[model samples]
Target: MSAQPPTPPHMTVDEFLVWASERPGRHELINGEVVSQSAERAAHWKVKLAVHVALLNAVRAGGLNCHVVPDGATVRIDDATAYEPNALVYCGEEAAPSALTVDNPVIIVEVLSPSTGRMDRARKLADYFRLPSLAHYLIVDSNEPLVIHHRRQEGCDILTRIIREGATLLDPPGLEVVVAEIYGAS
Candidate 1:
């Protein structure tokens, strides 16, 4: 039998970034371990695209100095953890053209898939909020017509709202995103 390659050791965020850059496909560093993201279903992709477009349009309509980035941009959570959200919004000055990581993201969006649903609602929710710059974390359900909005409140208190229709008003950055637009019905 052929010899198998040795398993890589747990890596710090910086090391994982360097290693992941040389590899193919998408990967996330979770608590010092490298976890490869699985293939997504069509429904997941559809919602992801819709969320990206909706956020982009909102930014443009509001004329805010913010950038909406789709998947492939990483957000560092800590020294040993980082996440690559399905979509994200960062305000003020834009990052460098070649930058692979976003240091400050005001809004983060994730389209839930069967494999990642649990983590998205739990682990990711907790981790994303750890960043002081994060104001909103939106979890879009691929199997249902739902969007869970998590907004940061005063002193670590997070306000969670389940939205099935209408719009979500994201203040601070001052932007509004209609639920219908995100589901692509309008």
Candidate 2:
């Protein structure tokens, strides 16, 4: 008897969630495949911390009922795709009680790393913009004080801004965070 080739493993979104929950480390579901994420560098962590703190502070200062979450909090893109953003904010009823994952995120931030920069800029960018509640997608550079802010406008056009310094107003949530504050230089 001739041996046949092994069948490629495929998992549904529900299966991936159940399987990933029992495993260690970080993993992302893309196109029905589980992909392990690499360990983040020091620079990446620093920038992520700054962004997380800034968002939390903004929510507190503004007295908004928004919740700021760091990495490990999954944001479901669809049935077969989920991502753990560097930072995210969920306001009002979108904030889950158990805090498992967020379905409606107002802002999602990603600190770009060399390994994931390409995917983050292209694939992730396209995927994240699909979230109807998403108002801003901030891609921060860990090596420099640069922030690529993508804000959805009146229509479908996204207003892109590259901020090295200064501040940008987040309209829907009505919070103003300076570029320096996000980089931990302020």
Candidate 3:
């Protein structure tokens, strides 16, 4: 058998950004370690795209100032951790053309797959909320018509709602996304 490649040294969020930019596929920095993301199945991709389109339409129809970004933008959770959400929205100004990270996102989205479901529901639910600017965290189910909506409330409390039909109201950024529109795009 051939010898295994040596593991790279632990890296901070800054270092991970530089390293990830140099490489090709998706990667996230979790607790100072680089975690390579697995290839997404077609279903996962469809749902991800659907959510992006839904959020984009909502932003436009509502005439909100927020900018919606599809997958690939990194969100730094801490000094040693950063995540590339499936989609995200940030108000105020548009991000710089060369910026690698989003400093503030009012809404963050993740489309669940078999491999990521647990982390998305548990770890990510907790980690994404750590951002002061985060008003909502949406976890979309790839296999079914469902969305786990986590909305930040007063103080440190976060309220979660499961949306299967109708619309999900995202305040602060102030937009309403029709559930069917999201799933229909897939």
User: Against the true structure, what is each candidate's TM-score?
Assistant: 0.95, 0.91, 0.95
Q: On a 0 to 100 scale, what is the lDDT of residue 103 in model 3? A: 93
lDDT (C-alpha, whole model) for all candidates: 0.92, 0.85, 0.92
What are the per-residue Cα lDDT tens digits for candidate 3 across 13-101?
Answer: 98889889987799999999888899999999988998999999999999999999998999999999999999999999999999999
lDDT at 101, model 2: 77
> Comparing 2 and 3 by lDDT, which wins?
3
Model 3 poorest 10 in a row by lDDT: 1-10
Model 1 residue 33 CA deviation (Å) reads 0.4
Worst 10 residues of 2 by lDDT: 1-10
Which consecutive 10 residues in model 1 have the weakest lDDT in total?
Answer: 1-10
Off by over 4 Å in 3: 1-7
Q: Per-prediction count of colliding residue pairs?
A: 0, 0, 0
Residue pairs with backbone atoms closer than 3 Å in model 2 (clashes): none
Error of 1 at 162 (Å): 0.3
